[model samples]
Target chain A: MNYTSIECASSTSEQFVPMSPAKTLKVYWLETKFEWLKTIRNPAFALPAILFPVIFYLFFGVLMNHGNVQAASYLLSTYGTFGVMGPALFSFGAALAVERGKGWLDIKEASPMPASAQIISRLIVSMIFSLLIIISLGIIGVFFGGVELSVFQGALLSVILVFGGLPFCLLGLALGMMLKAESAPAIVNVIYLPMAFLSGLWIPITMLPNFLQTFANFLPPYHLSQLALKVMQQDVGDSVFTHLLALTLFAVIFFVFALVAHKRKQN
Target chain B: MQQVNSVKHSDASQVVASIQGLNKSFSNKQALCDVELQIKSNQVLAILGSNGAGKTTLINTLLGRLKIDSGEISIFSSQPGSLAVKQQTGAMLQVASLPETLKIREHIQLFQSYYPNPMDYQKVIAYAGLESLQERFSKKLSGGEKQRLLFALSICGNPKLLFLDEPSVGMDLSARQSLWKAIRDLKNQGTAIVLTTHYLEEADSLADEIVLLKQGAIIQRGTNEQIKACVSSTTIRFTTPSYPIDFNSVAYLISHDVSGKYTAIQTNELNQTLISLLTKYPELEDLSVSRAGLEEAFLELNKDQLAQSKTGKSVINKGEAA
Candidate 1:
């Protein structure tokens, strides 16, 4: 209860000037990567996103050969799309909601870090998990089903699909920014299952009802799977270019919407 | 009167953040109205208010996390949430939820890399009193411990200005005192602090300036001495002897309470009343006269609003609900 206004006055001499945006982003990137490493280090969060798809693929592709069609090749592509979507939606969207609920988003916004870095890092982290799932699914497809593809083909497919999945990952981020953590699982599931089902990831869009076929084409996942299907055959189609453009457009729209929403909620 | 127009000052030393006529709303609800605030360098500006008093809204606006309906905000002479301004600012918001999966130390380390020269991990750990809790995952820590770890993370960046909203919400008294000391230490290092708290005592004891906000407008702003002048009455508490003093005899007496062996009186005339009390009740023991606490001052400032709210017609209360 002693008054020390004099001391308080003298202390304001030293000021901290902020770093440039690029420097701030660089720092944020390393921090986010480290954060991703921390999350993946835990068996609980890391194990499920990585292992669930692998296990599901094994059960459906190898163990249960219910149909006349060779399940290996068919399930490989379908499950690969499923695998990528798992991390993009489950980890990115769900984690976004949970983090927002906890007020971590506020903390990040209040920091010296670049705003774009926060979203980009989370997207990158999600993609990393997606990449792992793709690799696991691809290996299983090769070893079990006798699917013959050169390393170049396999590597090329991985690159294309990973990049193709970016739009979905961004879409999940937008959902996370908009929805509450408790409601995230439900909301994400609403979008996730439909895209997975109607987009030819589980069953080909051609086999679906005429209505769903048209609906699936509008979704990024349909374009993604179509691109993946063509790439696995060592070919790129007109659909690939169209899908990439559509996905990029979707990413931009969602990205801006999420940023604005986040900014609004924060203030 | 030496007028300090908290808004016009441009020198870094004069102000850490300068806000002018800020207005905000949520759908149809007006959350803030003509809110102007000035947070000077190295001073602890405690924003005191009840729940939904636009404390969070004001903080968010300063951080540029939320867009204002109308106003000008300058943090370190840059816009709020600007990278340059943010680099100088560190905040421990009421809503901060740590990533549960990460250990305390790793979180600290990760945040440290975001700043060019963050405080040493050991120092932040020691200051926040989180040495033992550093290895614990954020989710594993208790509420109080989580607050400490977050407090650690906030200071790790060595920010020039720090914002803490309800910083001691989950802390024990001892921890609260220690945290206040740490805040003072930070102030000594030239870090300006703008803290929001419902605990009036914390503000009374720690703040260099206290700005009490009600319905988004500042009801009162001043140092403790300046605020203490707002108290129109003095309080006198004492143990009375067998002779019971009649309340009617004391002209300045505003109110009196008798409980067991003690009698307390609140009065307006301090000197004349004390003289009269000595003459009338020489046996009065343990006598004490003191100015009003922040709680009393706050209640006085807020009495009209509280009364209106009691009548179920408070504008701010209604706005908050909407």
Candidate 2:
């Protein structure tokens, strides 16, 4: 296609000019950058997402555990899972609901911005926040709690917990699409806190009642925390493949819910 | 007026977009019924209507945001909302907002990245008159300033076709004037604009063609003057020391309103009404005669439609009735 001629053309033409790969990448990059900037500047999201897990880890993993390496290591893995979930859920769930209510999403829909750019940007920002949360928890766990871990274990745990946020991001996306802006934060909290506790993110699953531990088998966060614990050799006697399969199934289910909610909204 | 004429004369042959037999309904209520419209390059097409008249629906359908029940919409020779069409189209929809934490410059830059070809950053800023407020976070800006930023974002793509839905709703007088100036500049540069506004004066001053929609139908479509001519009435204003008791009985008088200093009378038969008024009260002073404005024409057209529907009679064009 003659780009200049198309620009100058007065009449409508049938030709479709695809955007270049570099420009497409630039769009995604800019979208992700601004999403990160917006969320970081929001004290409401930034403060809780970074601080809550660190505070919880200091009190539970360090102060309360009394320098027990076993307990500290166990809490570190679970707290890491807990920390990453905050950003993924709140950023996607609450922020998306608020934006949708404000009609900002409509403007984006009407624009040439690819729909995937919006989703991908939020996903990327959630992962970035996940990384921050893991590192913060790691610092508290190592410096204060006397937990010992090799570099390989630390890196593997961080990677697992950080990426494990994907299913939760999808879940948040579903909630954001389904809930009203006014109730999104409270509702996400209603879901987030209880799910975290039941999944053994706050305490080890073995400590929970037997029925509750059985119930944890059905929750995505439980699988995620188990995967993170597997990195530290502290998880229950389940195959890694079982946990992986469970998380994958949960991701597919959440994605399907998000897709359905999105379609319902469009109609 | 000269700009409108020049726009019509220069690039009127190019149809940037068009809709044929468009129909849309929301469940049971018809939102748009067999609508047809042609948007030409360099011309401002004003979709004038009151609330619930399907102006938004038509724009949404053209933007490919809503699917029409049975119709064809072609923009840039492609389906509405297609990437090719979106690449060349810019829209500032009503009641839309921006993320509060992003600075004006960042917002513009991000929106610019969405298009294959975008306007220069400085040019977009200048167009929106945000030279000094580039660093200001959107949360800190006033309502008008936020609207200006939204306008800037819409034009970031340097679109060939632009849709402005009630663009000046919250803008102050000066902000509105600047926006009008920017719109004119874009039109002069050959951008086709679809403006939906209830501000009849805005439509009057900016539109090369006015389309009046009522209850999901086009009641009238013509030039500003032609639409005004539909009412076929002239307004006469004069001040009298004592109010005339029987002014309502004047020949051919359509309506009358008395304010503090002047009593304005609208009549289809201008000469006859003036003669009768003058003969009855020779003291009438400060007399002035002017054609009915677009607002009066719009009200008259809508009123005629309401009367027709009420009476179970086919809608008769008031222009032809006159």
Candidate 3:
């Protein structure tokens, strides 16, 4: 057909070059941040996660006070860790699973966006939501809750607690991508309530059964709570180092599985 | 933007995608077997198959969303799922389930930023017929509206290649027609399209080339005319009140569609068969003849697979592997 002859003499003729991997990832991150912003502005998506933490802080940290000042102060730290866990599990995890079920992940895959950006965006969004929860709870703990922690202590508590809670974030990410949406809320509840109770969110670990205390000591929530408590109390106990190591280990394992699961789903 | 110009303006005809000896197994079930295909630039290749015929699997392989047990697939001369190649492709998967809280316009804007130089925001909204629905939350949109929104997202990037996996599933007739028009326009703009649809008529109408898949394998690949010729012949339909006529009497007969007081004989010799049928069944009335369509060819292509499943030679079509 002599197809080349049509544009043979044209100086504008060019080859179809594709975008680089790094550029594609950059686009994905930008779009994802934009999505996070839109999600933030809607209030519908943001309200439940944000409100849940604030309400809990008001109720447990301020209203009830748990009778004992030290216990109330302890609850403040525990609840800060507990507060952000909601969005990490309910919002990010449930959303990931449901989106996968509905084939949205597949849609993104087909786009020119980088695959890593997809997961990275979700992680960043969840982390940001978690950070907000921590800061809000810390504020109530210092001001309204009548807790004696200083601004420096409260800020340090929030920072440690944010990263301390990463394992839970990765755990939620894995669970959300693995399970079905119908079972997501139920499954999240199953994970959430027991972990919170066992890890002493509702009760002090010292009051729990010896078996539960031992088991709770191994969980990520326990580590996060311990880290938050140490910073808020200005007491760096020997347990703090163990909790950090354990939480880091849990995050490493979880992150590996989540990446593997994502790759498996892709192919 | 400078990079965008350098990339998009390049020649795109040089075998942009190639699939060779692909094999995929999910646990115990083989979803794709020795599948081979190639897609060039500026061609709308329509993949036609019944539900669960590995259409999605093929797409997953091409996008490198699923790993194939044994196969080679490359996109734009690079490996499949390569960032360079994937970044140049836009896609509309089966159904979009974007966050319900995000408005349609927001969704469009978010996806647009993923490309260096996407189409204008107003143009995309207009293209997807979402001008009226742009303010509505994604959750509030009707099925057709959601489909349109998804379509709008798919083309906003001005991608060189587009993958539409059942893009018009929930669309209305007008929406479907408009989508087809949009698809044609994209093709005219030199975009390569790979689409899968349950609508055989849509395939016939829009596909420059058709690939029929069955049981994770390519059953037929050619233009509509060439594939239809696989079961080429005309169907002779007639009704008689006096007696029932057996189709065996006619030579060159392929099959029959029999109902109460009516029979349709599919034959290679349309002229001779019609004459024989009229003379033999003198009481015949309301006779009609028509060419075999993609539907008939599709049925013929899958008939053996269906029979094999029934006889327990193959797994049930709907059975999930453990």
Q: Please, what are the lDDT tens digits per residue for candidate 2 over residues A182-240?
A: 99999999999999999998888999999999999998889988888887789997998
The residue-by-residue lDDT of candidate 3 on A15-103, one tens digit each, is: 33455677666676776676586568667558977887688768876788654567668888888778767777766577778777887
Model 3 alpha-carbon miss at residue B134, Å: 1.8
**Lowest summed lDDT window (length 10), candidate 3 chain A:** A5-14
Error of 3 at B101 (Å): 1.5
Q: Candidate 2 lDDT, tens digit per residue, B139-252?
A: 998888988988998999988899998888878999899999999999988888999997888999899989888888887888999888777778999874576548766898
| Per-residue lDDT of A127 in model 1 | 74
Between prediction 2 and prediction 3, the one with superior TM-score is 2
- Give me the displacement of residue B125 in model 3, in angstroms: 3.0
- Tens digit of per-residue lDDT, candidate 1, span A147-259: 66688868877887777778877788788888888888888888888778888776656678999877876887777777777755422244567877877888898788777
Model 3: CAPRI class: acceptable
CA deviation > 4 Å runs, candidate 1 = A1-29, A41-44, A66-69, A232-238, B1-13, B236-251, B256-265, B270-290, B305-322
Candidate order (DockQ): 2, 1, 3
DockQ-based class of model 1: acceptable
| Residue B48's lDDT in candidate 2 | 85
Ranked candidates, highest TM-score first: 2, 3, 1
Candidate 2: residue B162 lDDT (0-100): 96
**Candidate 2, which CAPRI tier?**
acceptable
Q: Least accurate stretch of 10 residues (summed lDDT) in model 3 chain B?
A: B313-322
In order, the candidates keep a fraction of the true contacts of: 0.54, 0.58, 0.44
